[model samples]
Target: MSSGSPLLADLIEALRCLPGVGGKSAQRMAFHLLERERERGLKLADTLHEAMQRIGHCTRCRNFSEEPMCTICSNASRDRHLLCVVESPVDLAAIEQATGYRGQYFVLMGRLSPLDGLGPQELGLDLLSERLGEGEIEEMILATNPTVEGEATAHYLAQLARAAGIKPTRLAHGVPLGGELEYVDRGTLAHAFGSRLSVD
Candidate 1:
């Protein structure tokens, strides 16, 4: 029932492309923004532009960061010998939310999907190998999702870990099949981290 202003229609289309937001939600958001104070809306746009311009993958773990290394990597209190390997930056953030881990992280950014033409190099497995070869990492905990591709990626990393003489483990119970870590509860995530099982 909107009057179909071109600017509003374009904004609605752009907002609809965001994940989990359907046509109604997108239109509502567009209308809300259009009704907001101009300076407030412009500030939001500037914030998005600044984040997109400054945020890049961390050089070591591939997590999103504003600098060469992520805040976790730069923290000296984190366990340098223990590294948690996750499928994406979101996975890493999920695990961190549990607030029990004191280890570092390596983000794969994706899982191994042969049907989708994704492989080791595509997920930065080479960079992982290099990190493992550095001899600083003694243990790696795979925190990939419980889907087929996630399982395959974890096993693949296990093989690489064994070849490099590093202990490899997978997240324990509480994470359901095909369920992403981001959606799991904090207590379950903490328990999973506490009960990690060796993959050797």
Candidate 2:
């Protein structure tokens, strides 16, 4: 549905480019910006333009950065021998926030989904291989999500780590803490049961 103004319609269409923003959501955003938040909208536009122009992928970890290297990659205090592999930058942020992990990271950017045209090349496996071969990393943490594609990607990465003589470890998957087994889903419950640890 087009509004009387072509510019307003264009703005709504442009807003629809954001993830999870549909036609109605975009239209509401467009109207809100135009009617009440024009100054903030202009500021956002300027900031977005600047960020788009300045931010580029870090040469080391492939994370978004204003320079060739990201802060995490360049930090001297982080453990260089521990490399955590994640599917996306968002996952990396989550791990950083939730855990006291002080290790280097390698962002896959996307998992191996041949149907979606994301493969080893697109995920920068060559770069990862080169980094592994450097002999600096002692352990490779496979922190990819527990999805089908993520499992495949983690397996591939584990093989790569083994080939490079680096130890590969996967994140523990199971029922959440403080959750009862009856309330947990069957898949998660089964996984937790099968992978149970013995009490000392």
lDDT of 1: 0.88
Highest-lDDT candidate? 2
Give the alpha-carbon lDDT of every model: 0.88, 0.96
Angstrom error of the Cα, residue 97, model 1: value is 0.4
lDDT of 2 at 121: 99
Q: What is the TM-score of each candidate against the true structure?
A: 0.81, 0.90
Model 2, total clashes: 0
**RMSD for each of the candidates:** 6.4, 1.9
Clashing pairs in 1: none
> For all candidates, what are the clash counts?
0, 0
Q: 105 in model 2: Cα distance from truth in Å?
A: 0.5
Give me the candidate number with maximum TM-score. 2
Over 4 Å off, model 1: 1-4, 37-39, 174-200
